[model samples]
Target: MTKTIKTVSFAAAAILVVIICTFLIIRQTHENVLSKETVVKKVEASYEGKVTKATQSKDKKTYDITLENPKGTYFVKADAISADILSMNRVKAVNPSAMTEKEAEHLALERVPGTVKKQTRQSQVATYTIQKEDGKTYEVKVDMQAKTVLSADQISSKDQQKTPITKKEAKTIAERKTGGTADDADLEESEGTLIFEVDVDLPDNKEATVKINAYTGKVANIVYED
Candidate 1:
C-alpha cells in the first residue's frame, strides 16, 4: 500500500479500537440495573397512579415513566448507570417544590460535613445520609414542599479497625444474613472499639442494621428497624 493509504488505514483501525473500548467499559461498568417493570411498579406505588406510558432507554439501562393520577400527569426518568446507582432523574410536571438529588446534596452539604451516601424519597419527603470523618453517619430529611431540611440526626457510626474483612465482604455477609441488598455501609470507631455497620434493606420492605466486628469479621449484633 502507498504511504498515505497505510496512514489512513492505521487511523481508522485506531478509531475502531477506541470505540470498542468505550463500549466495553460502559458495559462492564453497568452490567446490572433495576428492571423497568420493577421501577414502574415502585413509581406507581409511590405516585398512587397508573403508569400509562413507559419507555426504556435505547441502552436498556434507564427508563422514562409517565404516571397519570387524579392530580395530573407526571414524568420521571430513572437513571440506571454506573456503580448500580438507582435514582430518579429529571422529574417534571409533578411537585414543583421537590428537589433533585443534586439539589438535595447541595442543601445537605451546606449544613453538614461529609459525603452523601444514599438518597430516597418517601411520603413526599426526601431522606438522605452523610458520612462524616468521625465515623458517624447522619440521616437528614428534607421536606418536598418547602425544600428545607426537616431533621438531621446522627444515626450510626463506629470505630472500625483496619481488619480481617473488607467492607465489600462485610456487605456480602450482611446481605446473606438479611436476604436483602446493602447500602450506607460504614466502618468507623466508637470510643475505643472498631466495627462495621451495614444497612441491609430486605426484600419485604424491612430494614435491618447489622454490626460486624472489624477485627473478627463476625456479627457483633443485629437489629431490625420498626
Candidate 2:
C-alpha cells in the first residue's frame, strides 16, 4: 500500500511539472506571434499617404515636397526629416500624417534659401509658396503648421523662343547694355522680345542670375535661381 501511494504521488508531481512547462511554452509562443504581427501591421500602416510631386533646388541643396489628400493638399521639408528619409526614393514613401504642415514648411525652408511668401488655407488643407532671393520659387501644401509638405512644386518660367540675330545686330545690342553679354542673349517665346539671362556668380558658388526681356529687355526678374 505504502509503495503504491508513493508511486501515485510521484506520477501526480510529474504531471504537474509537465503542465506548467506546457503553459509557459504556449504563453511564450503567443507572445512571439503577437510581437511579429504588430511589427508587420505597423510597417503596412506606414505607407498610407500618397506623394504627388517633389523637386530639389538647382544646387541640390534644398528639397521641395508636395502631397495630395482627399481633403486637399500638404507639404513637407526633406531636411526636417532624417537625411535617410530625404532621398528621392524615400520621399516618395513618406507618410504626411506623421508630421504637421508648419513642421514640413520649416524643414524645407531650412534647407533652402527662402521664406514662405504666402499661405492660403482652403477647406481641409493649406498651400504655401516660398520666394527666395534669386527669383527661385517653391509651392507647398499642408494641412496644419506641423510643417509636413503634402505636395511641392518648384516655380520656373517656361523657356522663351529664340529669334534670329545677325552678329552685327548682336554686337550692337551688347554694346548698348551695361554688364551684358551677347552670349547670354536669346529670343523670347513671344518672338516680339529678346530674353537675356544675366549671370552673377556669387562667392558661395551660388549664382544670382536674372532674366531680362532683351528686346524690351526690361529686367523681368532681379533674381533667377530656379
Candidate 1: segments with Cα more than 4 A from true spot? 1-95, 156-226
At residue 82, candidate 2 shows an lDDT of 26
- lDDT score at residue 177, model 1, on the 0-100 scale: 84
**TM-scores, all models, native as reference:** 0.30, 0.23
Cα lDDT listed for each candidate: 0.74, 0.52
After superposition, which runs of candidate 2 have C-alpha atoms over 4 Å from their true positions? 1-104, 145-147, 158-226
Q: Estimate, for each residue in 1-226, the C-alpha lDDT of model 1 and write its tens digit.
A: 6999999999999999999999998877566666667777777666677888878788777777776765567666766542132454434455455677678778877777788766767876887777788768787888766789889887733422332456887898888888899996798876676788999998889899999886667888899996
Candidate with maximal lDDT = 1
